[model samples]
Target chain A: MTPGRKLLGHIALLVPPFGWLGIFYLGSLSVLLLSAFWQVDAMSGEIVRDWTWENFRILFSDTTYTVIARRTTGIALLVTVTDIILAWPLAWVIARKVGPRLKLTLLVLVALPLWSSMLARIYAWRLILGHDGVLNWGLRLVGLPDQNVAFTNIALWIVFSYLWLPFMLMPMVAALERIPASLLDAAGDQGATPWQVFRTVVFPLAIPGMAAGSVFTFAVTQGDYVAPMLVGGAGSEFIGNVVYSNVGVSGNVPFAAAFSLVLLAMVAAYMLLARRFGAFDAQ
Target chain B: MGPNVLMWNTKDITTAPTSWSIIYDKAYAGVITVPDNPIQIADAALYLSHTKPELGITDPYELTQPQMDAVVTLLKEQRALVKKYWALASDEVDLFKSGDAHVGAAWPYQANTLRAAGVPVQDIIPSEGATGWADSWMISTHAQHPNCAYLWINHVMTPKVQAQQALSFGETPANTKACAEMDALQPGSCKQYHADASPAYFSSIKFWKTPVRQCGNGQNTCLDYSAWQRAWQQVKQ
Candidate 1:
């Protein structure tokens, strides 16, 4: 095709999506940003159209910024690390070593939960992790005693890690499978042990996938409300809970908008820092 | 503008053209929006005035003590029949619109829309009473149109103006004097939009108060939402 025709075709493909994005996402964000600057008469539900930094001032004061920032970062980091650790072996086994049929079966197993509704999957975790749930039931069958372990921070992390495991494994497996078997064989032939071959070749080749997976897990889990809401009990109050409560129950839209903007900025900064450190470089 | 006046409508369920037993029996099983808003309480009080039922409620003013007790009993009995407890106006609207609920409490806007769409949604004001919220028009300290705002408030609060609004919004008129003028607007509209609608029932109806902690200045200071949430969870359990 001619360049002009090709360009026209591309434009035709892009225009509808661009139009929708402009009107819905971009326009709405712009309005939300504007709302952050305006004052509200809470009782009257009236909007006073004046530019002010009072909302941002509230965002910065009273330890709000410090608390959410620290919480989001810590939760994101924890989810990313834990998901990767759990996914590494599963991905490695399914990538190059397993037979094609078994590999596909295992892949189906990994992908199964992705087809379920996010809310249903999270609630399923609740059933599995509740005080009198299957996990306790199983423990009791095995002569283990029961306790109030489900309503804790650890349970939240486990459920979050489970929820994001597929994201990590799918990427890592694709990255690992792309490496030729000959390369690993060569490393082993050069007197490198099995562990050394993996360290020198397999791990190095999967860095990009690791980076992408980590980003996906961290970004998603940091803002996820369902898992925390279902499993975290009172202690599961993350940035998502704060944002939701501020907007809905509190009816403080401007403050919620400001906090959301701050969260976006922090996530962007963290991703930039990760990329700058060559976290995505596949050796 | 003076505080935007929130408006609502309710049916006269107490002395509807039908029998009280049939209505209540049908309502409990039929699907109705339980009043979750302040205005709904007032609207319900008004509806109760006209009807004399053999069962629990006949007076609206006695609603809080009696109503809460009734709800606890009803819930214990018919908890399974209630699909869900809706917390927002849109949720109740969805129930009616989607046919998840047939007879229930609803906001005026939703009812109007449903009626326009040819849905037979009777705005029930229980014979016991009609319950509703009463909002005042208060200008902000920083209002730009302080004079206009006050003008708007007084103008809307007048008998004729209040009746006109009551007819349109389906709310009980705030001005008691507005009752006479509303008769010209519609046959039953005035009675439906009475400020003290279903007075016999409403005289006993209790108003919804914001939850408060055991403190002197009860401006949402006492019981923080977190505490309320914990209580809600315990109540649910």
Candidate 2:
């Protein structure tokens, strides 16, 4: 086919997806951005056009800014680190040692939890992490402190880590699988320890995949409201809670909008930094 | 001559406006706005208890653990079809405007907005009647639009407007004549809304003094708010 016709084919294929993205995601975000500048009448619930920087001022000055930012950033970093540690071994096992059929089966097992609703999974975690929940009940049988043991920050971190594990594992497995067996044999032949071989050969190759996984874990957990609401205590209240209460409790949509924009900026800066550091190298 | 009307303990109903009250009219389901501030609950409870006890609600003064449990159970059962458990008066206004709620336990100002939005909303004073807060329509010390604002106040308080507002907004009109006019609209149904200016309605609906374990009085030890919070959490769990 001529280059022109080929371009036409590609354009036709891209149109529907492009239209969907433009109308829904981009359009909604534009409106949300507008809402950030608008002020809400305290009594009337009316959106007044008194364009003021008061909303942004609150975002910086209020206690909500510190509490929400600290919790969101803390949880995001923790989930990212935990995912990396847990994913590396599982990815190595799946990519190198397993039979093709067994590998596929194990992959299915890892990915299966993703099929469940995010809300249902959170509720299930709550059951396991409640004060009188399954974990405490199990611990009580073993003669542990049954009260105030579960339902802490530790419980929330565990749930968040569990939720995002597959995101980390899948990418690492894909990256590791792409590495030829000859590369490992070459390292082994040079009298390098398994640790050294891993450091030089495996680690560098997997950095890009690890970075992608980090983005998912960091972004999602940073913005997650429901997990903290369902599982975490007062200390676990994140930016999501601030955003929610601003809109619902205080009826201060402009401040909430400003807060969300700041969050978006933070995530954007993180991604930009990751890219600058060569986090992605598409093969 | 119209029966005398006395306003009692409640939040600044002016904050909510009067247009968001239709939710209560549809379901006849008892409503509860939560994080359960005792005074707010008490006002609604006392109002309901005296004027419309057939709803099987207890007085705020008499509210105890068992009563709370019953209320919770009732709320849970009606969760599927409640106008809503309104957190903000704005939310209540949205519910009224969208017709999601027919009779709401809402702020008066919210009900006013809904009426402006053409929803035929009313804050009904139930036969066992309504409870709302003290929000005087006064000229602010820093008044900008003084005459217009005063006109706005007088217009709202006018007898015909008050009657229409009582029927439409679901609140007890301050004007006794308006309340009477509302009573005449559906005769027997209006009695509960008058509430007899009961002492229970007035004194009982004070700001919820969260019980402190070591209250200054040294007579009786009150359970702390933390205990109540823990208990509430356990119940949810």
Candidate 3:
């Protein structure tokens, strides 16, 4: 083939993906940003062709929204930390300690929950966490007091950790696997304790993986409305729930867009910070 | 939609609560659940209309900024007592059945479902009255088959079909004639669903409608649905 013809064919292959990124990804993002600055007609609840900072002003000035932002951020941070801690040991066992067959089985078990619909899994948690749920039933069977945590922030915390644990685990396993076994043996030869070796050698190296996994765990929790709506109650309203009510019930697209931008900015800031910490080094 | 019933566990308390104030009581903290909808704001307003007459909220859906502020304050207090805000009727049903929610604002359907599951609960229309919706069939403005749309509307409006819908969906039929047909389908179903309700009974319920700037009081200054929605988010927050 001629050099020019070959080069043209290469560019042709790049078009579809670039088109998707540009049109679907960046394009929608641009629309969202622009709509945030648009105005809403109070009477008919229509988006007017006018530019205003009213939506953002309400978002910032409102104390209730400030509380919401804190709640969403607080939960997201809690979930990220919980997932990292939970995933660390399991990732270690599967990556280093297990036989090949067992590793495969363990990995499958970690991913099995993801195959089921998230909605179904969350609902199952209700069956387990509700007042007369499995947990309470088991407690009663053991002659323990019945506990109620079904529709509170505690439920949100438990469900979020369960849902995002796998996301944390995969990256964690990848990071742990990348660690050379020689380092551990060398540490032992130098008379370093196992705790010392893990703390110094294993933990620092796993940072990148934990960081990578946290981007998913943290960001998804920050933007999640479904779990909160389904499992969350009075004090458990998230930023996404407000955004949804604005768009779905009120038909206030501009306001919803504005609130979404706040979420985007928060998640974007976290990702950028994670990137700065070299979370993507493994990738 | 049926009236937003105030339901409580029969075993938890022997006496049925008469006021909406019980949902806001601190005694029920972390066990109260209500619908997680923008329309829930109206319920809060309806509660205030009786208690705080100075706010002058004649229609639960219609409110001035000051009235909204009062309602918001009341709801924010109630927020702390809530265990969760449920979206689906089944969620509320499960909550009550599981004994997670001892007292909550729910619909008749949940009360029925819970009772069917052998959970002892009683639902009452609080002294402040209640809010509800009368779902209707509407033809799309831009329907490609306008003739078919009108035919469908007419078909559903007929007494026999209306009775069928009333029985199946558990909503009162608009056609008064359908009430008799409903009884024919299932004896006492008409009275059970309140399809043959007295005018006074009908007036007690504040059926839901999209709040507009131009309200029933003929004032252009009333806060619209968007405002209620925006305020609802803050109240929940």
Candidate 4:
């Protein structure tokens, strides 16, 4: 085909996806951002389309929003870090030490939880973590004191970590598998210790993968409100919870939109930082 | 419609809690729950309206600035005692069934579900009163089958159907004549839910409504629904 025809073919290929993104994703996002500047009529509970910054002003001035935003970010960071620590060893074992057949099994095992309903899994956690729940029952059998971690930040942490662990594991496993066995063999032959080989070779190469995983773990935890609603205790309000309540319960769409923009800004800033740290470098 | 009632584990409490104040008691700290909504602020106001008469809180939904401030302060104090604020009836049921919460605010559905699941639980409208919802069926103007909608409404409004719904859902029927029908359907179920009990019983319940700044007493100084939402968020935090 001629170069002009090839260019036309390429444009045709891009049209469907670009059109979709433009109409749905970008279009809806723009509408959301625009609504954030509108105000809600307090009496009638109607969205007044006039431009105003009252929603943003309230968010900035009220210390409650700040505290909620901080708490949410803190939980997201903690979940991401916990997933990394938990997934690294498992991913490494599957990618390196395990046989191909077992590696596939291990990968499936990591992903098994995702197949079930999220609400069902969170409810299962509720049963496991409750005061007289399975965890406490096991503790009694083992002669250990019950932790009583249900409905606390600790419970939220456990659920969030569990929910996002697979996202972290998959990328790390892929990165680890890409490392040639000859490189490790050479490192071992050059008098490098096991710890040194890991620290110098495996760890550096896995940074990009870890960063990629962190993006998912961080973003998902940051925006999730359902887990918090079902499992979170008092004072465990996330930014998502605040935004959801505003929209669903309060019927204050403008404020909800504004609150969402705040969350979007936070996620965007985190993505920029992650990108700066070479998260997308492999791509 | 069912109201929010105080529910406690029957096995844990020898004497059922008789007042809403039991929720605020320090003894139940870390084992009590309430609804995770701004509407719950009215419950706090309802308690204060009876206990702290000086606040002059006649209507829970139409609270002036001072009354609202008092309610907010009371809720912040109650916050420490709350184990979790449940958003769903199922959440409350699971909490009670799993013994995560010993006592808290709940709906009749939660109590009924827990009882059916073999969890020993009881619910009551406390001495200070309770908050509840009243639902009505409305047909849209643009509805394709307006006649059918009206027929359905008329059918449900009949004493027999009303009693059936009231007994099944554990709520008082709007049709007072349904009391006899409810008794026939299920012995003592009408009295059990206080159906056709007394005018005072109905008056005691502060029906749930959106809080607006315009007070019933013609005062515009009351806090609106957004304020309640913000205050509830602050209280939870």
Each model's backbone clash number: 47, 37, 2, 0
lDDT by residue (B136-216, candidate 2, tens digit) is: 567887998898998899888877777666665455556666656666675743454542344555543332444345434
Segments of candidate 4 deviating more than 4 angstroms? A1-5
Order the numbered candidates by TM-score, best leading.
4, 3, 2, 1
DockQ for each numbered candidate: 0.03, 0.03, 0.80, 0.86
TM-score of 1: 0.56
Which digits, one per residue and each the tens of the lDDT, describe model 4 over residues B27-46? 98888889888889999989
Model 2, chain B only, scores a TM-score of 0.43
What would the per-residue lDDT of candidate 1 be over residues A151-257, giving only the tens digit for each residue? Answer: 35677788888888999998889888889989988998899998898788888888778887887888877777656555553234567766675566656677677
True contacts kept of 2: 0.00
What TM-score applies to chain A of candidate 4?
Answer: 0.95
Indicate the TM-score of model 2. Answer: 0.57
Model 3 spans > 4 angstroms off: B214-220
Q: TM-score, each model? A: 0.56, 0.57, 0.95, 0.96
Q: What is the lDDT of every predicted structure here? A: 0.61, 0.61, 0.87, 0.89
The model with the greater DockQ, 1 or 4, is: 4
**For candidate 2, what is the lDDT?**
0.61
Weakest 10 consecutive residues of candidate 1 chain B by summed lDDT: B1-10
Give the candidate number with the greatest DockQ: 4
lDDT of 3 by residue, B1-237 (tens): 467779899998677899998887898887788887878889989988888888899998888888888988988888888877787788787877777788988877777678778999998888999998777677779889999988888888899998998777667778889989999999998998788888887788999988888877677888877777778787777
Model 4, A62-171: lDDT tens digits are 89889899999999999999999999889989988988899888888888999999999998998899998899999999999988799999999999999999999988
